[model samples]
Target: MDMKIMRAIELGKTYRDGEKETEVLRQINLEIEEGEFVTIAGPSGSGKSTLLGLLAGLDKPTTGQVFIGENEITSLNENLLAKIRGKMLGFVFQSFNLIPTLNTLENIELPLFLNKIHDVNRAKELIDLVGLSHRSKHYPNQLSGGEQQRVAIARALVCDPPIILADEPTGNLDSRNSKTVIDLLVNLSAEKSKTVIVVTHDLDFAQKAKRVIHINDGRIQ
Candidate 1:
């Protein structure tokens, strides 16, 4: 049996401001098998990114449970959640949030340093894997958009996390770079046996997933 790497049960999220409340996701139940590539697709304002954040343990659900491997993360405190996230999840954002002062190698190794692990070898391996080895000494401002995003992907993988969550990873790239990023993400699951989940509004990108979960109005459609 394939391991159920990630699961969400009756998940929901709502934001409250003053007396107004806005419910974004509701009763979203999902399961992702180990080594599977999945995409959550929906129109803008349909809560796709919200769901991704929840599953990544970056945000807490207003109601329900989320399981990453055997850990039910919905109720884990910030410190515990951070610990689990560091060990099990790698996230790539559409914005490619690389530090301005850090070079590609430094950025990739940041996660390792955060965990008190000093392994330049692992960081270099990831940079090479992402084809950024030559640009290791280049700062974020010194690289092109595609290169920068690649660095972000390498940084995400440097920790050797089992699962990767990307939110609209191709949103900032041209067609060619988008294809490159998509191919890398696909290979992570197909070849590396890592569970990869992406939240994207682009139909083309969503189609790349082995399983596409269509979400609309906070519910799976």
Candidate 2:
């Protein structure tokens, strides 16, 4: 049998605001094989992003478990989870979370720098892959929204993690740029054999995935 890179068993999340409780996700059971391209789609408050966070080990589920490979992440502490995330997962956010002061190349290299990995060649390759080689020296504020997002994608791939979790990657781009970013992500899974799970609202983009998981009211539909 093929390896399952990510799995969620009866996963759930709840938030408390004083006397009230909000159930964001409930009984989300899922399994993603290595190199699969999966898209999670839903309305704004459907808990897609919340599920992404739990899968990435950025947040613990309120109930049940999340497994990345053989490790049960819900039981791990923050430090260990951070280490696992750095080594096993890459993340891209909707807002280009690039450092304003850092140039494109620098922002792409930041993750490696934090992990004490000195790999300039790998960083350059990712920049080239994202077609941002010409703009490598530009700062985030100096680039257009599309350019910044490309830089963010390059940064996510710098670590070359087996799995990439992208939250509304094209939410800030125009139709043209959105297609570009989505195509790149598809190539990452098909050509490079990376497991990619994306949370998106775009039906057109969701249709490109190998599997589309629709969630509504915190439950899979």
Candidate 3:
């Protein structure tokens, strides 16, 4: 099997405000293989999220290369990147980021709708996998934080992307909810043979991963 899911070579990200420049990540090199569950942990001001964005092709690096499978994401334009992202990656955000007006079922089906996959059965299966079948008709606003996040997870997995990128996925949930989401994420990755990379400030969450990378002061420690 082709084991390489993502690779970063000398990756760097810098932010500019007025005359000052902030270096977020510098000379970072990493590799994530297929079927791996890896967590990146760092301090609040560290570059965990920045690195995640780069790895997901959400943001471009100031310097270096990012390869997703056989494609060089750094060299691709936004249109091409978006296409690749749609086909190969899924994302879970801290805020859940669901459309306010859409119900759980509709929210989970949005990606498929966008990609023109009109399979309601597939979407229902994802909801069942997240154990949210009963809440499928509830809107994001009507559900609890955990329920909303579960809907987010169902949405993310609906596409069945080989790579899942989660940024503080459990940040807004309570302890029990956090555990539920984390366990579901881990189980999904293992069962589906997906590559999972999460950026989080929670050490416990990091420890749950098969491999953990510590980032501090813009470098992997």
Candidate 4:
């Protein structure tokens, strides 16, 4: 049998506060095929984001393993994880985390710079794709919330990573903006054959995905 593009086997996560231990995720067994668009829906503090982080190698799991393509991410060190993240994963957070001082062009270029690819034209193309070409010179503070979020999307796509893990991407948007962003994400993922994993509490948003994995109290149901 062929190995899946991504896999999580008996995954678990725990956090400690003072003398207490809080178990966040328990025995998460998942497999993601290449080019799949998957979503995880759960209530707050149900470990949805925690799963994303572990899968993306942004955080370490207390037990079990996570694999991206053929790479066992949990076996790698932090430096290796950073390299893998640069080459394989993209993330979109609910906060639309953009640097306030950078203009659209500069913000989109940040990822490329981190990867040491000096290509300004690539950044311009992403700005155009996200419908922010006209705002290329505008700072994040100058753009509307929706526009800023679009810029964030552009930044995430700049590296052309194969996997995109988005956490509540549209949570801060209005209805129309939410639709616009979600539609753009779906379209982009399909066009690029990217694996898109979104975590959201919105039933309508989750339903649009090819597969929706429901989570309650840290276990997939």
Q: Model 1, range 185-217, lDDT digits (tens) per residue?
A: 999998999999988766776777768998888
Listing every candidate in turn, what is its Cα RMSD in Å to the true structure after a full C-alpha superposition? 1.3, 1.0, 1.2, 1.2
lDDT of 1: 0.90
- Candidate 3 structure quality by residue, lDDT tens digits, 1-221: 65788999999999989999999999999989898999998889898888989998989999999999999999998889988998999999999999999999999999998777777699999989889989988988899999999999889889889999999999999999999999888886788788899887776778778889899999999
Query: How far is 18's C-alpha from truth in model 1 (Å)?
Result: 0.9
lDDT of candidate 2 over 115-186, digit per residue (tens): 889876988999899998899899998999999999999888898899999999999999999989999999
**Per-candidate total of colliding backbone pairs:** 0, 0, 0, 0
Query: lDDT (0-100) at residue 187 of candidate 4?
Result: 81
Off by over 4 Å in 1: none
In terms of TM-score, which candidate is strongest?
2
Return whichever of 1 and 2 wins on lDDT.
2
| TM-score of candidate 2 relative to the true fold | 0.97
Q: How do the candidates rank by lDDT, highest first?
A: 2, 1, 3, 4
Judged by TM-score relative to the true structure, which candidate is superior, 2 or 4?
Answer: 2
- What is the C-alpha lDDT profile of model 4 across 55-108, one tens digit per residue? 988889999999988889999988888898998888998999999989989999
Give per-residue lDDT, candidate 1, residue 2.
36
Question: Which residue pairs show backbone clashes in model 2?
Answer: none
Evaluate residue 176 in candidate 1 and report its C-alpha lDDT on the 0 to 100 scale: 91
Could you tell me how far off, in angstroms, the CA of residue 177 lies in candidate 1 after the best superposition?
A: 0.6
Q: Can you give the TM-score per candidate against the true fold?
A: 0.96, 0.97, 0.96, 0.96
